[model samples]
Target: MSQQSNDEQGGQHRRAILQVAGAAAATGLLGANAASGQTARPGGRDDAPLGARLQGVQHFGVTVQNMDRAFAFYTEVLGGTEVMRDGDFKGAPVHYTLMADQEIVARERRVDPRTIGVPDLKGGAQRLDVRFVQFENVVIELLQYRDAAQPTGSGDSWAEPRDHMSPAYPRSMHICFYVRDDVNFDTFIADLEAECARRGMTQVRANRTVAVHSEQERRAAPRETNTIKIHEGPSNGWSIVYCKGPEGEQLEFVQVLGPVKKTFADAAEARRAATNRG
Candidate 1:
């Protein structure tokens, strides 16, 4: 067979696998740009205004203090498929580092001398290590700066009252994984919690699941309760829980009860049309 034919066959096989594993959630999480042949641009005014070309998240990166521990937690505990083991693909084992024209990272990170130290990688860095792991549709790039001075955590811990950080805090970001509502999600959480306990991982939030209510009703209700309010109307019936990853990165797990829509716009439009029909 021709190379083009072989490539087409390979793509079909991969799509079939994704379909069996719940293509809606996968495509929604990974973004339609990949499947639709749309090029993704950096988030800003440069991006298409209509957002039709926009795809979902392809992968996210996390800098780890200890690669082995993080790898174990993600793979052994969370069942992430290992794509590439820790290694440098380049024959010389070079560290790929870049500094923006205006030292953009330093400025954006708001580097405070008292809180964080600075590494003079202006010339460049070497011995950089990275690995890739796939959790269903999402690919997590685990990175480590071998020679450069990289902090272990974000320096804001929930345990530390003075330096505590929450989702409400600025620059605090998190990643969420989707679990099927039809499957034994509760059992899955239990097993995960047990594995974490076995590995001596600190569960920041002991509660496994939180009930969600609609936006309007939840807005009026007290916020101290165990349940969390979800603004996405399509995600109204889902249950969610939060936990701390190996490197103190915030992680979340969501069990969705409603149909997983491709985008929030689509979900909102469906609700609007339904109301009009009614």
Candidate 2:
């Protein structure tokens, strides 16, 4: 199946699991009460290890132009929900949108341009526009500034300023996402490449990890340029690669090693595997 299709399937599977789990919880049939005779008090400690336990991601903020339009895009295209309205940030009226999957809750908040660490234009203070969208442990912030006269940077046209970084200098900043394993990694990369081609987006270089530099080399590196190092991990199952997502957002796709994985490692492995297959 296509990568998008796979993603849809995975999402459906997760939603089903969550539904079952939620039902079980409501009936006291899945947690400590179900597994054991005793129930721990609220805020009580458990014997589970940190690594084995599930920790949730709190929230990430993004800026956007029109809250109505952005909200529609996220909810219609990305399967997010409009949880709260007219939320407050620093006493400023803001919108708080929440999206969730089985594993995490993504909280999106709108911000005024003046609130971000940028100068206010028009010789006056104005609120910035921001939006947050979260999905399955991932939080994406979309930012849009109110004042056009202010010194602003470019970003993926579809996304607001805060959703991305200034692309004036290429390879300066990027976001990464981790995949399950090599098979899923390969599927995702292929799917993305195909989608880009279909959408007429150009394909840049793709490769595996290698020892290209160290901290010393990085220090000596020129101001306008830097090396992108790709190297194999201990298990060699996970990999990494960099690419530009819609609206020119620097994105890194990582293939995770074990059950729980990191986006960087996953991207490195995916790049490597793609290179080898090619």
Error of 1 at 65 (Å): 1.7
Off by over 4 Å in 1: 1-54, 85-98, 101-126, 148-164, 203-235, 259-278
TM-score of each: 0.54, 0.38
**Best model number under TM-score:** 1
> For each candidate, what is the lDDT?
0.53, 0.43
Q: What's the count of clashing pairs in each model shown?
A: 1, 35
Q: Per-residue alpha-carbon lDDT of model 1 for 1-278, expressed as tens digits? A: 57865565455445444433343343345444655868767883356455444344566887666677777888888789766543221111121122242345457777642233322332223233556678776778776544434333222221222245466788788878887657565556556756786887653232422344553442233334433435566566566667667677788877655444345547778866754453
Which residue pairs overlap in candidate 1's backbone?
31-56
Candidate with maximal lDDT: 1
